[model samples]
Target: MARSATTIRRSTLTVPVAPLGPENPLPPLLPRDDPHRIDPRQRATLPPDMARQVGYAPLTSVLPTRLRDGYGRDRVPTDLDTIVLENDRLSVTVLPAYGGRVYAMRHKPTGRDLLYTNPVIQPADFALNGAWFSGGIEWNIGATGHTTLSCAPLHAAVLDGPGGAPMLRLWEWERLRDLPFQVDLWLPEGSDFLYAGVRLRNPHDGTVPVYWWSNIAVPETRHGRVLVPADEGWHFGYEHSLTRIPFPEWRGADRSYPLHGDFPADYFYEVPAGSRKWIAAVDRDGDGLVQTSTATLRGRKLFVWGAGPGGRRWQRWLTEDGAPGYAEIQAGLARTQLEHVPLAAGGEVSWVECYGPMDADPTVVHGPDWAAARAHAEKRLAATLPEATVDAAYLAWLPLADRDPDDVLHTGSGWGALEVARGGYALPGTPYDPATLGPDQRPWLTLLDTGRFPEEEAAPERPPGPSLVGGPWRERLECAPGGPLTDYHLGVAQWHAGDRAQARRSWERSLSAAPSPWTARCLALAEAWGGHPQRAIAVSLAAAKRALATQGVDPVALAALARDMIPVLLDAGRADIARRVFDRLPQDVRARGRFRLLDARILLALGDREGARAVFDAGFEVADLREGDEILSTTWALLTDDPLPAAYEFRMRPA
Candidate 1:
């Protein structure tokens, strides 16, 4: 056998470690009258009188607020000096202030940091709710995607396990769903790897959908390649839809290699039915990192932005310009980014993943030869200390005995408690003023009653209504503040009732609260109907951009946004723009049978009646056009110079 390049040895010395740097404080809240104030439309569903009485703040305010000591303080740095773990070959720093994220990790042998470290600790409106920072290993738990708790502080401690092995432990209570999770980062003696063991416990009496994904970022390099042991995997794209494609090969390109100036792509791959549980990324220098976990960590994902202008802009936004942009190598508990694992109430799920450095020839990195590459990588990994040893070290260091159920500081309500729990006093020297909540104020009551309390008063019962549209539904929505969908329905009712102004207002409010493709399309239609066709086109484009920027991972939203824009663009007499929008839509969505009429319309608008007929025929062969039957029939009659029916004129009505 060839001599191993590096040998493992045991050591007994106090590891030299310290806080990596000063904490990066969360930005102070903008003044109430600030131009960027959370939109009133978001609060449109709330009863006006109650909204004023309780002084309800938007959900974004609770995010990025400290859960522990720094609560309510403006500019509280998230990087508190707490604990660091280091060995001869590696060093790891944990930030107790910033959701206990592993701030940075360095492989001593190569003097290279395996993880990307953002130079500034700035928060942006990037998370699902709002406010997130880029870089480091982000621990996400809750419903799928980046969880709400990703940026808040988590309970953290330094533990001594068997043989005095030091491990850094971080945990947080997912108060939104009442789940408790803990992560342990262990760098054992003389080992060149960092081992992580995660445990999620459901304390409720009923099962809940739980999502957990560890997002690891590394610098993007020209020769970078990601290796996952699979021949075929599920490809997730616009609208969260899935298509199985040959591994690492997408659209006739070897996606495992770095992409230069291509459209942005987010793909998740389900491990082949009997593949090993490991993924690795090799850089240009042939030095790389390998991450191996148990079968429970089933999903492997790659999120990339090709070296295109749009991709470069995102890179600059995430990091400073001139710095190499990074890519995410994510590990998830489910099969895809949108899929959530079902955890039984009172059940426990635990798994361990190992990260270590690897050196290999760059030629074997990118693959249609995944089997050969995987075999070589496996052989290299087999020479290291047994995985069981790392698992034992983690189990011994888990701080289960120290966990507190009432330790709810990592939640939205936990941030609220920082003020209300302390005699209802607001943060000192800050602009925030706690509302003098009354028994019937649902917003204030909900905030105060989170965690350990039960509600003191029930919401007033809404009057029974015959229809969700029109006056009765509008009145109910006004009284209780339904979310975006309810407001959207109200807008539709207003439009049909010839109250165009009110409809526009309702749609604007709906978009402000949650910018979804459906809501944007409705807003555009409402604008066009109200005689602002240019504004309608502009808003449609803005909505598509926002959907791509903030909710890029949502393929369904992207597809819907693209599909809805076709009609809006055509309505605005911008057939050229409509063509561009149509071209950008995912082939899967554009090829769907339901979109055939839309395809035909676009062709007709472009003066391609012959092509339109062909596309229409193809679409009809695959899809039953029940509601759309009239549009197609009329278009065909017109094409053949046949007599048109009275209903043909209805096609000219507002779509």
Candidate 2:
């Protein structure tokens, strides 16, 4: 009997799991008299109506839960409990435990994994909110960066599509934003490609930005090359300057080629005009993987850590020694992950993406020569079998006598699966009972209050306090002395309390520990507010330079710091220094509405009234000038020696 091109089977394999490691202890839960607390005046600045609408809360009221170590010594599972979907061309393994990640995908013909797989399941403090792991195809939805649900398990079920074709369905709730989404993954019979359909739903009345990115990691080697159909790309760095550069060539080297030097590079590329809808990575041997999605998915990104010492250090931190360092080929729903589109209340958006293997000629070294690879991809895409139409009505079917309560299985209409142990799954139209389900099938409600859940409720409720002068925030900081997050929060409290010196110290200490552009920006702001303009300029400039030179720093944070520095430097009567910093900024940053006014001011101060007017005129066409339009208009009028635009606005303080 001949084997089918694609088949779905449930099986288990013993996989290594690391024990929970040491806990990072939290501070006390009581408020105390301290300078590092939010001031009454600052608290009053928050509009009551706005706060009520957004469910705003204070930092002091939120108590930290006991930390659990997710990374410890490794141990393998005794049971084999995994689902495998494969075709003659490729194989995919799905793990329900690791947030339903596509644990491994292999190109069967070459016996190599199309996606990188960690040797052991080791969770670490890598997530922006904490608890993340490397490798595999991670589905990020809702907020930007890694989704809070990245480390949690998801509701999963196996279902049959039209004509009884096998499919796996995984769904989870975006608790923070009150959004729900589902991903259906299928490998059609006799097909070489695996397809994913993502459906996102917003049920609330308030509009919110929707962010989704599929992060795929692959083995990084000198011979590996990432190929995107785009001819040119937009690159944003730590300084948050969005520079347009020719594709493949960034800085000096061809970035499409795998990491060869000693630094990390992160580049987000927009879809080029008339480009095909796919991105791929091919090795020196010409064996590679390709991912294609609908035109709705607009962004392609490449993240690589070169073979330098810094890159190697990060490699060791992310994985065990000897484990291969990998690069990521990510796809985003917008032009960049930082840019999100609005999802209107009660709205829905969905799209489909396909993944498979491609064989290319080893001799194709450059972008121009990638025609062979593209042709190979086109053939595979053209050969993709049509998916059977899935029936939606069968999703509510009752369990069969022999079926495990936790096992998600296909019904004729839809899928039948157990609810997650932690309660967040509110199936839009489908309802289920928690009391009738077993422990594994029941919702885990306790996790919600413990801050382990990703919902907004995990944040602390507002506590009644005029200021942190007699608040619990001080005790919390005392308890968690070395935590960078704690220190940053403490600095915020100090800044609001009019203790600028202490705030500067706290921010500096936080930066020393975590080295984030965010903390550095805060420190610069503290210095400027504390009447030290020179120190503020120095701090902001140093931070910006460091961010530009270093890898792994968030470009958004860097951009904010650089943008804020212009106003601070100009206020300090140092337009020359401001111009220097502004010149280093990416063209996109300079083109911002706020920066246009600053640019005109700098030119005006340099005795170039005509240049300033030209910039202001250009700003009207290109910038989204909002709050400071009147200020810019007045500056322009004064530059032209026209009649004063308005009475001089001034404030006076008693002597």
Candidate 3:
């Protein structure tokens, strides 16, 4: 017979005796026969060769150190063991059974360092052995193969320190369309990888159906928020609506959940398809946030979005306010993408995404001279970004991220939480805040409190604007604080692409007349967005100065507002200006919060994973707002390359 040889697993160190003959194997192997013969007195005996080997032979007598330690105790043989390798900057563990597990561990000795994670392989609760392959390469089989790989430049992984400890892990697995997908796991000695993944084979023939998704989890907490980028286009098989992105009716009707209830079924955000994507959620305090994207991957198109509370079939792993939160990338219905490797008899596909942790919001890029950095990145991506994909996809697909602004308020009367009209008041304590509008506007608060807009009563010519009920309502409102409530209308329009110059003018005038910090800040933002950087800076600085001048602006509110402004500032190229503001920030504002959602975004932009992870660790608390369900749409948009913003507008006439 040709010399037979035993296949050795290079990744492991076990030496198994192989190619033994059936007759005289190492020791006479026992079979299910000849245990006790019909003669009761006869007993089975070891074969002569086995007995000789067992009698104090060097191979038989030598035992592992662990066995020596537990010599007298009852124990089973240790089939597998892992050891951790601690170097100056990393800690890696190796497992005997799985080769190398827990591959990389990096510490940001000075600033935040970044690292990438390999895709997880979760097998059944027990089994755990998988191979890993890494590096940048393109295969030539599928229709879109090579062209797709050339679509985008690669983004490196980031590392950050979460509060001086290890918290976040990032991995960038970039892939393009029309390519055979191959992912392999690598195991080094002495490490046991935490999660086990199972590989599945595709059953589809070569028709080339596209599908796959990623599941990513973060620590969850009560104060978490999600942000997504916006876009404009119609690449996905759906239309956009003002309140909801319309999925094909055939896709099935989507349900709604209370903004403060459970996690949604499927979160989707509507952003412009195929455009520069950026979105995030900030902890109320602005300390942390996580930003991510795959738009830079060759041949891969990316959409922006997130999740809301309760709307889909599965319960969210996040506590309405708990630890360990997560965001996922999905393809098809949840069932379609799980371990599904589909291709023709020999076809395959691969996908990749990049995630960055930020200690602050991306909007606040001014302070650090990131212009050069931004320019460098932009130039690199521009060289390879596919013309076919740029700006082609707009709108976000985050359902949970798109809840109606009105849904936020509800002061329950006997009527329960109900929708009031534009400029309406609630029963009170409804998920929405009442203080948001001026008092004059409260009377006009959608009359649902009693009825629809009340008919006008005849009276001597009254000044423009609103009037309340009973006892000289007009005079009381005129005397009572904050200027005319017209700012609300202007604020809403400012949020849209309306005239920010005019809007800022209106909001500023009103704030000056009434003097509310919120109004002042809003007016400032409008000015900034409308090409009035100096004025915008002045406005916010004034508030900060005033607060400093007048007993420090409510530190908490100031911090919250500042955090919110970070992204806006970054987007507008006001990083330098924002730096000034950051320096003057209150001591309390600088203190860490429960979750640093905003911080993650900032860290991501700066490519500091260690810092980003720190913020994410603190910002893990995501509240269980029914609004979470709204995020599913965004999630869908990101995973499926669909572009549509939440609130697809359709001209409507009262039926």
Candidate 4:
């Protein structure tokens, strides 16, 4: 047997990355704007204890993290910074610059990639920040949706581990929850499994909501089966509700098979406590990947895009025409991704997760008897890597969790440094280095050092910079002298804290001082939420007018504003106004795929069905089309009375 010690090395991964264009220059107008997400339905079905924690420490806004929807289909070869940890049996590739994603894991014995490795970097509107790519194992740590860190970087460093071995640590301060978390990865010589010790800590004086999920994507196979130690699971479908469904076979289809269903869905398995907590996606030969973790990580799930046309189209759109489809088998702290667990002040939770290939007897593993199949998996897992080993790994890592990172590999966002600067936090293994602070954090740092929020003119050409929605920032903004920038940002922080009335007042003051479009957009959102539709409409129109008045404005910025404004107008039955907004754009901008989508929408509303159909006939593609966005097919249905085009069909749920 080979005796190569666990080693960490700097590496480069060359893949095709569709460039993520500049962020929308507009501050998010909606107070809790989340048009890209699906709200979990049927809360009444949740038990009493589970219901109490669903909205724990919920985020009122995704402030500071701007949307990244400005990407196109064009791809170019790019080399990304990566950290690789390898031993005799396994080699793991981590992309520190891209959300610390475990980009690839090659099992040496089988010579196979355990996780679905995306062939290219294709940005889609699936994450909280508006851009995400499929494949690899991604650590989701912020909220119920795809994390704001999906495309963001993380601080990485090499650290000494047990017995002179080396471990790779990825750490970051999650801005939304205002908490710090870290993941340590290492592999032992001759061992088949890779180990990850994760911890999330809240240093504040009050409780905060925390959500974590290790999402592992595997190839979707016709004969693949996902097994969990549960008899019944909660099924969440786009039908807008959660229904109780039994495991293995549900509704005459084997739910464990990733391709058995007809629509995209989530099965939150009811893993009874004290049972061996594990999940695996295995082929017909009963050889594939298996994941097991310590007791703190209780939830197990299987997410699949079923065999439906929309599902098939989405599978193709995310990668390429002939790329194989994949499904996600995930584990989280709670029973489902829909809920968050609360961590008290000065409290933290830590656990260890293990991943490796599961090789079991095909007959028993894929047999109809559920208990026998589960027994086979658990038995093999215990023999291969016992829960005791995982527990010991967690215990050993706890003592070393506070050690300073020995060798800095890559630098992430400076938000952590700003947090540490404000609170004097003593986070250890995850150093929030002050050196990482860049232009974005300078304004906030000034507010912390000096006693005032810096002043800046609110104009379309120079929109508001990054926002800090933490409580301390809000308090400082309150005490600072009134100014357009100060008060406008204060309103956003206040709104994120759920103080709607006070937030509106702050915005009102900002608008009174400077009639800027960004502030007007916020005021419009407030009116819309307050049931004042007419007032909302008036403010929205003013925002558009203010935006259009600026000279030498960025076209991409204008496109974002128009995209958001047109939808609001159309939704409110003001397509004439929507048309007005669309017609004002430059001809080249209008010809862009995303705008052309709006063009078709507006044409349909004006009873020009032929024109709307003509837009589709011209064959334009929505470059940043969101996941599950059915507008193209719906518009086609309403206008042409013809079969939906294959290019436009991206429905993820059943008809």
Report the number of clashing residue pairs per model.
15, 13, 190, 0
Arranged by TM-score with the best first, the candidates are: 4, 2, 1, 3
- Tens digits of per-residue lDDT, candidate 2, 166-285, equal 667777655434456777777766556777777777755567667788988888877788877765776543222345578666578776875754555557775764555677888888
Model 1: per-residue Cα lDDT over 1-655, one tens digit each? 3322221122222222221222212111111111112234533443354234223222222222221111111233333453567777787766665566666778987898888776545454344433455677888886544555656666555554335565555665564344567776677666788888788876555776677788887778887887777767654432223456786666877877656326455566757656657777778666777787766787788777666544554565444447777787888876655545668866878788888787776666554487787677766666774545545654664543233332222222232332233334322111112342233233323323441122122111111111123243344444554455556656655654557688778778866776655566667765765689899898877765555555233554455456556777888888777777777666876776546667777778888888877774453421222211245456666455654322232121112
Per-model TM against the reference: 0.54, 0.56, 0.27, 0.96
Per-residue lDDT of model 4, residues 1-655, tens digit only: 5487788999898988899888876666463433323344546557866766664555566776777877888889999888999998999999897799999999987898999999998988888767889999999998877888888889898888755579888999898788999998888767899888899999999988899999999999898888889999988876656677888788898788888878898899999999878999888999989999999899999999999888888888789768899999999999877788889999999988999999988898889998899889889889999889888887887888888888988888999999999999888778888988998888888888886777753565656887877788899888888888898899988887779899899999988888877788778877777887777778888878777777876677777777777777777778999888788888988988998888988988888888988899999988777666777877787886678878888877665
Candidate whose lDDT is highest = 4
RMSD in Å for all candidates: 17.5, 18.2, 32.7, 2.1
Best by TM-score: 4
Score each candidate by Cα lDDT. 0.56, 0.57, 0.29, 0.84
- Residue 276 error, candidate 4, Å: 1.7
* Model 2 clashes, total count: 13
For model 2 the local lDDT of residue 122 reads 59
